[model samples]
Target: MIRNTILLAAGAAALFLSGCGEPRAYGKVDKTPYEIRECNKELYRGIDTDPEKHIDKIVVHKKKRELAMYKKGKLIYACKVSLGKNGDKGDKVQAGDYRTPEGSYRIVRKKCDPRLYKSLMISYPNAEDKARARANGVKPGGYITIHGQPKWNADGHADRFTLAHDWTEGCMAVSNKAIDALWIAVKNGVKIDIYP
Candidate 1:
């Protein structure tokens, strides 16, 4: 009787160790591999392009969701961007409208330290924007910028995540690596055109 009991116990232990062949999972599974999850650290950390070169202008195509950097009328760099959450509604006319303003502006300032990774402030309320806002009796939202990934995005592994949807309040957002390059290459007072 003791020998039979021992054998039965051993069989039960073996079945338990087999774990029904496959483990069970619940909810959404994150399939991003470890390497891609930490991609921001592994990608675009070096200066493969000309380090001494500088950009003169920036053009943002809202419809295309792209930002292009140019030097002396020649295209040098272009990157995907996330625009205002309500950008499809049209140009911004009032504060909190959540639309990217259309027309020309200047990069008035560069913030090395910002809530985001980095940023170049844009002069959003150009005379035209202000006039239009005033005529409509609404405030022209300001503090617009072309900036890098948010703090949550860190090195920018989440950039693709951001690019998949329009997420900015009204700013143009790029990857942290792209901002690092822009921070070094773009100077204050550079002209930028935001197009619908």
Candidate 2:
């Protein structure tokens, strides 16, 4: 009787600790969540944006850590993203603030950096950004982008970690393969809207 009582109590405690009676999940995700234990193309297939899709708008939900692509007004593709340290807090106010700016922006340029793979530069510090910064006596920062993970992380490590946290300096980031597809699907003048 004593052993049975102890086992039941232990099970209850375990359930309580797991929160909502379910274990927490981790690692990379695509259309579905799965365990991506390490960097191996053989082990974990990368998430991709369809190149042929006519992507017109890119929407970012900072708190969700997701970037969704749209055609006309319909959702077409989405991929995991990492953002600046203060990405989920509020809009960026100044240079070197380490916060991603909020509101509508456009892809003004595309850049190549061997380390970051490829990038679509967003026109941050738009008129609104400038006004807000001016009112606060600050400098609205510029040169933000939606880009790929660092080359080292891209090779295989990102799937295990990048989506789990914020690590950028006011930029949004995706996996290399995702960027490869996005690089082709999007062009200068595409719209990008970011939200907290």
Candidate 3:
């Protein structure tokens, strides 16, 4: 009888701990992965071909939800993107909310987002972000990146690029395909300027 009670307790504990989505706790997530081929296909569809393909600089505008790729001084590619809501301000992203940040950043690491389709991790809330946040009265939250969509959400699946209002938690969001291309076009240490 004692053994049975212990087993039941353990089982119950395991059940209670398991949350929706992945095993990630309420506020802990490292990376999420999804198929790259589809993402790549979707990203190129909307890209402007008029611009040449020698990417030298990239800029993401949160308010505009637009990404501009430049080679030297000439524009090579321009694609619509999704940014944060409430207008990107200082650093420190709110939990489960949508709002892209505005600042200069770099692609530190490239990883697959298991939760989203795919993602290119952008280093946000850097020293400057923290400093500004500290100077202000708000906290400088972390976990900012350029990623794709989460799993199993079909509402906006058809029109990922057309939606308005910044809708990311202090992270820039582009189509999975765009990110995949970015993974190849935009190299590490490339400067990405995100603006409001």
Candidate 4:
């Protein structure tokens, strides 16, 4: 009888404690949020005052930690890029912990979670990378791609000023909105040179 009473008291205590826990906040997202895809299409269709300029390719320099977009061999856009969390100058990332690779590559494919507003797949670990990694006995890092905020922020809205700095593991990253524009402009097999 005593044991039964003790068990009942513990259960009641647990229930009471659970009810006293803090309540989580739940509310609708602000309607002011920006949409990347819509913005990208608008930019592409807009009249260009400078018809002579055209973006041709992209170059990622690890030493300079920068991302430069080019057109007809002239730089059209340039921005800073954050490399692997471990910092620049290292072998390919064997695991996924947000580390950017260091080398020249090309944009081979572009894919997204669809659920995710934007993402671009870059072809990393070329023959040179594979040979280098094999020489060192470490696997070349793989799955390098440009992407936007994860599903948690799938609305494709993120503060640009804050995200402008380097922040990708091995892949290049721009604002979810900016990335959307690049996705349309850059095609598959477009050369992307990453320097160390």
Best of the candidates, TM-score: 1
Q: Every model's Cα RMSD, please?
A: 16.2, 12.2, 11.4, 13.7
Q: Once model 3 is optimally superposed onto the true structure by TM-score, how far is the C-alpha of residue 139 displaced, in angstroms?
A: 2.9
For 1-196, candidate 3 gives per-residue lDDT tens digits of 9997875566444322321122243365442245545445545564312233436678976656688877777776777776554445643443333456667887665554445555556676688866776777566665667665544332334343324435554556566566556655765566788776
Best by lDDT: 1
lDDT (Cα, tens digit) per residue for candidate 2, span 40-114: 231134322234665899999987888998988998778898888667778888987778888999988766553
Report lDDT per candidate.
Answer: 0.70, 0.69, 0.56, 0.55
- Mind giving the per-residue lDDT tens digits that candidate 1 earns over 1-196? 9996875466444322321111234355332322322333323553322447778888999999999999889998999988787877899898888788889999887653324555678988899999999999999978788777654456554455567667677788788777767777776678999999
Tell me the TM-score of each prediction against the true structure: 0.72, 0.72, 0.63, 0.61
Task: For candidate 2, list the clashing residue pairs, or say none.
Answer: none
Considering lDDT, where higher is better, how would the candidates rank from best to worst?
Answer: 1, 2, 3, 4
Whichever of 2 and 4 has more TM-score, that candidate is 2
**Residue pairs with backbone overlap in model 1:** none
**Which ranges in model 4 have alpha carbons more than 4 Å from their true place?**
1-54, 89-93, 96-98, 114-116, 154-168
Count of backbone clashes for each model? 0, 0, 17, 15
